[model samples]
Target chain A: MSDDVAKFLDADIPDPTDFPADAPGLRQLDEALRCTMCRELFEAPVTVNCPHGHCFCSMCIRTALATKDECPLCRHAIREVHLRRNTAVEDAVRAWGLARTFVLQVLREKEEAKAATVASKYFSGKPKSKKRRRTPELSSDDEVVEVGERNVSHSLKGHTSSSSSGVVPCPICNKSVPMQNINNHIDQGCPSPKDADLDVLLSPSSKSKGKQKQEWSKLFQGGGAGSATTGSKKGKGKSRGADQDADPLPKIAYDTVTQKRLREILEELDLPTTGDRATMSARHSRWVNMFNANLDASPSQRKSVKQLMLELRRWEEAEEKKKTRAKLDAKDFDSGQYQKDNKTTFARLVEAAKPKAPKKSQSPHEGPPASSLSPSDGDSIAPPRRTEVVTIED
Target chain B: MFEAGPVSEADFFTWEALIMGPKDTPFEGGVFAARLTFPADYPLSPFKMKFDPPLFHPNVYADGTVCISILHTPGDDPTMYEAASERWSPVQSVEKVLLSVISMLAEPNLESGANIDCCKLYRDNKAEYERIVREGIKAQLGL
Candidate 1:
């Protein structure tokens, strides 16, 4: 979990090698990386079994499944258990998180160097033609140096000077300043840190962030390699014979086991056992998946058994609510009650559906045009349109 | 998104899109053009998808407006034919809607069809339905 926290903490550092977070290009990239639910860079990204290829963070999907068992983007049926961690997307986001600042810094420095060369050319006593030819070489040399610095930074743990000269590149501004004056340059010359950045990085809430990360990582390591493969293989099993790798949890045969034994098992796992036999079996199955899945997560994302139990309860409640809602919906559409409530509306719709004046050319099989389709039948039991131009605003 | 963009830069609310008829369907080889009109409170509510020149499909109206469960508003459905899960929510984007429309074209929902004639034709006479839809596609392309 320290690794996860370290990654975030590193993001707080204003590195000269990175792009400004607010740059237009970075903003566009941010949009692509953001989860639709949280509107933040994806954390534990999971792709649903929807045809639209929609992705949501694990926490977001859990929250969403609490209310609806469908894809948010396409309204296709989906299950939290069926969600596959989008490792490719997760890797991309992780890579971007580390590389954004370095890439941006290189681009900024390159542009600045080009501007400096142009200014020097104008001010110097050199001929325009000679300066033009030399400027291209300088710019190309600058790019090579930038690339070299990037390669060095990736390989090295700490910053390294490009030259052994007394001057060293300031990590904050990427400016070559005397090694002794580097601290002075950062304190006096560099621009003040943005207020938003300070608020996020220096906030009091982040004080205990390290502790939480430690706890999460501890839980993650407990589950071991089987859990890791289960997390990765869960969603990739679209074809037959992949079910064996889908669930890491050992399936308990609730039917064969006595109720007392099942209750004991739930107690040993520290899961709730208040439900009936059927409910208990379902609850236990969900808990096993949740527990093993948490093990598959990175240290920062692993959930405690208590949290998993709560999630299981929420899922059960949502399922119960859906069943009741379906029952109510069926009851609401009772033919007798519907006709009694909308008799007048139905009469008008039927009347409107009839041909206004019989035309010999019109065939019975040819349905009425959209304009003639009764407004009542469009979406709801709304009143029929009396005129052609009765456009209802959404 | 779906090889679709706004018809004009100024009016982003309305978009002109071209959906390549999905493979393995009667609509294959046809490039169907349509218009998407998004509401101001989009994502919260679904946008309206209408074919430029009417499409002959069970789920599509004669005036080109498409009627599918995905386009319906979230929450309690007035028609009760669609489950709440099947309806639109704030998370739905224009890209998802277009993809759903394309899939709908390939596999029309005859149960709650917007076009009764097309629905009957599709159920009782699939050959005729395919022919009519193909002809409509050809007419749209002036072929």
Candidate 2:
């Protein structure tokens, strides 16, 4: 018996290359595997007596179901004693695996042969030179790249000089122009190269939210800065430098409303917040980063992403609050619109807004029954009391 | 020693009897049989039993009778009815009753007997008592 098992394990497999490229049997196995409920490789398999030859895991067929039951795949009723393991099916599986390995090996050999043919043509060829090569002799990287339809002279035909300030590389035509022209290149793939510097001053003054404009003048006038980097503080007044008056608000300020939104975003994202001073600065910075990412989107796309974000924020708030039952305000009811329904009023403009609860329509299928809430049934409303006395010594 | 027996369980249960007459006893050279018809509540109550041929032994009754120990109803013999050993118990089987009868034939305890006249006859007139018992055995055997 041991010898027989060893023989079975070492059973010779035929080369799968011998089968045609479109072998029907391989296709059948793929189709069969797709149909298998476990969607895994077959194990101790059994075939019921049904004519279609549907197979199943033998143990599943035997124990996962009832005694003397029908075959699941074919619906053919069978006796418990009649179910038999199909050793022949296992032999087919082994043969299939061997065939697949042999076929893959054959394909690998074919690919190697093709690679050798391509190598011989490239490595065995001689290089071209300026004199020995004929006029039309081929094989030049520069000429081939140019011939790949760069048409560089024609590409620069209708344009001259960069208009924008900082140098921006044009992706196509391999040209470096300027930043303001990037939108032009992206829009029409051609940038007018002029008017570059006037639109490109560092406008810390123009962005003057509060005292920022005066602070810039002090920066130019040379203030408390260590060096006389500014021209001179020579004739400045008793009042401190304008830079001192500056609040140093960052270029992007998260206003109270946006800051509140930012905290909701961070909390929704479940980022860990440290209670110590060391991370308090980082937690504040993270709020700005998440806020700008939502706010500074292109104006058209901005509304939807922000809306989705806030609605998702609301859902997350609802989810986190789910563990505790909602407390109804003892004095407060939803006078319903006064209950912050306006924040959601803009939401309906976007199609994905949460639908408001429809006004309570008293369909017969719904609402309080007519039998109830009537004055005659008022006395009947309260449940009867034949209270059973329950007591415990403990 | 007496011991309990198997429950008599069947549609209609019967007891198998095999009694022996002891030697040198007044009722020797004879084997007798008696059927004890017990009610369902046998040990809680009494049974009606009698011998085929009545004898004139000290423990036997005035009629055709075999009076032995281990056959009285349950509880103290309130009438001071019979010797304590003669009353029945749940543990007493047919075999134990047959053995008791054999022992009674050898040496009868007449002090606590039901038939007072037979007890007196055995003590006063042993020859006459033996003769009448022998005659009863003969009639039973039809010899």
Candidate 3:
């Protein structure tokens, strides 16, 4: 195999085997996070309304449903309309994605620590007595580990020594500001205040805390208002949240529609209209499926229209390449080899055709009738000169 | 019971495979060769599998093509006896199909036999069927 193909095949997929045998929960966690259809981490996961509430990546289920209406897991009847955004599972996946590397790091560290203890015990002569005496010290060692954990967290949060010191660094513009004023400084897009020292002395922390509370309450009030409106307008239009005003696209009955109408649909979606009728229908149908599935995702996780178009273009290009490759393969076909391979089938067909003469006049004898009609049938079968011309054209 | 991969690195749609005949059956200890032809939109459509130098079994056609419910899609039911649940779905993979084929070799579903001659021979003269199958295996192995 070529190095590139070998490397492509060697790409790592996170599986239960990545964890040590002792940690069973981590393995299950990894498995649970994967979509059953694609066997990859769920992307925009959505839950079906079945009794089991099976969750799958929105795109995966949508594609599967496009083929068959039943659920891939339990084989229960399901519809695209019953799919709901599974925000809880989505949040869990997001949190797991962030913590996976750190969890792996900690597990490796613990393994190394255990190995170091084992080596120390092996090297020392009085292992039992030393272990007994060091029990009390181990408690203090845990305290030191706790402190080490805090340091690691501080470093991860980019705070470093800022927790002990009053000055906090502005994350965006990278300037030191008072701890109390950091939020306001960030709220103002990290602009240098005209009188920073004066402002810190004048504005007490209490006022800033009250302002943060007001912002939180305002956010809740907005959410409540949005929910009330959505509740009232639920059946009229299934639009949810502020940004998701685009309703899910209904499936098109491609058979009933004319090619012109299909082109109009493509044009309506701002998609390219250059392909043939079949290609256009395939492109539009796939786009509708993707667009409808995108509506099932939480608004934050939804892909933009441009990204969907790009995906559609990529799919169309792949399909085009496959079609051309199929044509080339047909051109490369060795008819002689094919006939040789299927010789029995050809012989059987010839045998069936030959028996037609026997059917016309049979004294319950096959050979005599065939022999009697051979001259006329021979003349009738002598049209190969036309087939020779067709072969040249091919 | 079987291992399969692309016939060549450049073409993933065509695969070459080797299946060891299931134990405790007439076909036992015989290694069979097969080819799998996958559609461009696979997992949505089922692949085609045919044993090379066709096995002498009721479920295999004279031309070596396999006749199994799982390899047929839900819509393309020529036999009309297979249930929708037993037919191909996107969830069914090549591994599942191979495993099903192994069981099929052990216990052929004679109700929907692809080779009538084999099915009749199997039902009427059991010893003759086994002798034919064993001889075919020996000939395949050049033993």
Candidate 4:
């Protein structure tokens, strides 16, 4: 069931390694890479010429420009057009995204190796020669090649060698035994081990690998993912035999296109066409982003258009709801401006509410009697008057 | 992490920061320590910045609380002095606030003086005001 959903939804390849997301080094890297404005990984990063040298994603700066012309960091006057795209930062973010997976894999392997060593020490009755040879080799390689190709190759060699000895490591207990006896070892020999480890080692990879191979074959037939899918679908289902790649879809001239035609085009693409022209345009842009983002994903995880459309619709609804809520909240309260403008009326209400002050003091001839009152009395009376006014206004 | 100021957190909600006064200002060469108390709904509401051993500045009240437009709520201004855009917004972080405070020290807004006496002195006798401010900085430093 999930396989079908995965086909339509751009699924991220779940990291095969056991690296924790919150590992301190990874967290620090995440923070460093995050845009100052959106607090997310930089997308089309741009640096503003502020004194403080703050950088924000392009979208964030555009949004900030709508309200304030000043830099968010230093309040120095900055125009959106003046923002220079930080190619260096953009490259850094791209490199980090690709490197993150490899780094996590290496770290998880190192951690597992350490755990295996500790377990070997605890279970000392096992053949000491195998343990001694493996420990020094693993530790030396770990220290020498902490983050390069050498470490991965070394680990791969270690796995092959252990397998060659008619012994496959019981993944659960990290114990080496014959491949034929591995299942029996796990069932009877190893103490109650984490079931998750077994599942991780066994299931998802085999299923995902098959799906990946199918995707690769599809890619080769189609030429490019985007053009191929659109061409095949648009060819009235008869051009399946055409070995040549189709031309890319013509860009829709939204301004020139009639609303009816636009809606029809959207319908053809299996996209939602329920909203107004602006919303439709927004939906279309979001669809393009989803489509392009899916194409950018590893071949195995590329999503179908139908799934991308569904995602776009969900996102649009969420954004619409958030905007409506903010509008309602802003409209509900005037933030004490009303009280400040109507101070006299509030003072009168306060005087009226007070336990019938002497008529002589409250007389119209007293000429704004608040000034005549003692400073202490005036201070005591002012706050309640403002609060009372606010309540009445509400 | 600041070079001009070192910030130490008492907790997530409370922080103490020592700011070195900006160069070529009356406040230059002084290390002013202030406490920033973040409300539970911080970023939504601005943090309260209070200088320890209050500095006599037009924007700082006698009680040591610094009054700046950036520290005001991102709502309709009751005083009508600051635009809503100039007031606090969630996008404004703690680093921005500290930089703003330092800038505020260099260029005091005498129009809305929280310290009335300092405002009057600053307006009437610029030299005397500078001398007095220098003395205040010296006293804080025990010079």
Best of the candidates, DockQ: 3
lDDT for A225 in candidate 4 is 47
Better of 1 and 3 by TM-score: 3
lDDT, candidate 3, A1-394, per-residue tens: 2554455447443554577868869988978987876666677789887778999888878888888888877778898889988889877876676456557756666555555554554566454445555575575366455655654555556543445458755543346887777667655534433434423323344243444233323322343454454454432222223326777777788899999998777655545566678877888888887887777655655655534544565465567656766765675778898899999999999989985765455433211122222222111111111112112222
Q: Write down the lDDT of every candidate, Cα atoms only.
A: 0.59, 0.42, 0.66, 0.57
CAPRI docking class of candidate 1: incorrect
Q: In model 2, which regions exceed 4 Å deviation? A: A1-394, B1-18, B43-48, B62-65, B81-86
Tens digit of per-residue lDDT, candidate 2, span B1-143? 11221123221112322233566876665555444544333322333445534555667675535666576643446666574445664334455565676688778777767578878877888888788778765654545
Q: Candidate 1, residues A265-368: lDDT per residue as tens digits?
A: 76555444565788778777766656545544443334333344434544655445445545654546588877899999999998997876566655333322
Report the Cα lDDT for candidate 3.
0.66
Residue pairs in steric clash, candidate 3? none
**What lDDT score is found at residue A126 in candidate 1?**
62
Which runs of model 1 end up more than 4 angstroms from their true locations? A1-33, A37-98, A103-394
Best by lDDT: 3
Q: Please, what are the lDDT tens digits per residue for candidate 4 over residues A1-394?
A: 2443334235332221223665666766766776655565666666788877778766556555545677776678887557676767766775666466557656767666655655554576465445455566666456444443554667867755665558654443345667767556544524323434333333334343444233323332333444545554553212222211222233455898888988777655545466688777766655544443333332322333333333454465445644554554555667587789899999999989888766676422311123312112111100111111112221
Give the TM-score of candidate 4 (chain A).
0.38
In model 3, which regions exceed 4 Å deviation? Answer: A1-7, A20-22, A49-51, A104-243, A328-394
Model 1, B74-98: lDDT tens per residue? 6656768887767887566666677
**CA lDDT, candidate 3, residue A270:** 49
Ranking by DockQ: 3, 1, 4, 2
Order of the predicted models by TM-score, top scorer first: 3, 1, 4, 2
Give the number of colliding residue pairs in candidate 4. 0
TM-score of each: 0.37, 0.24, 0.64, 0.36
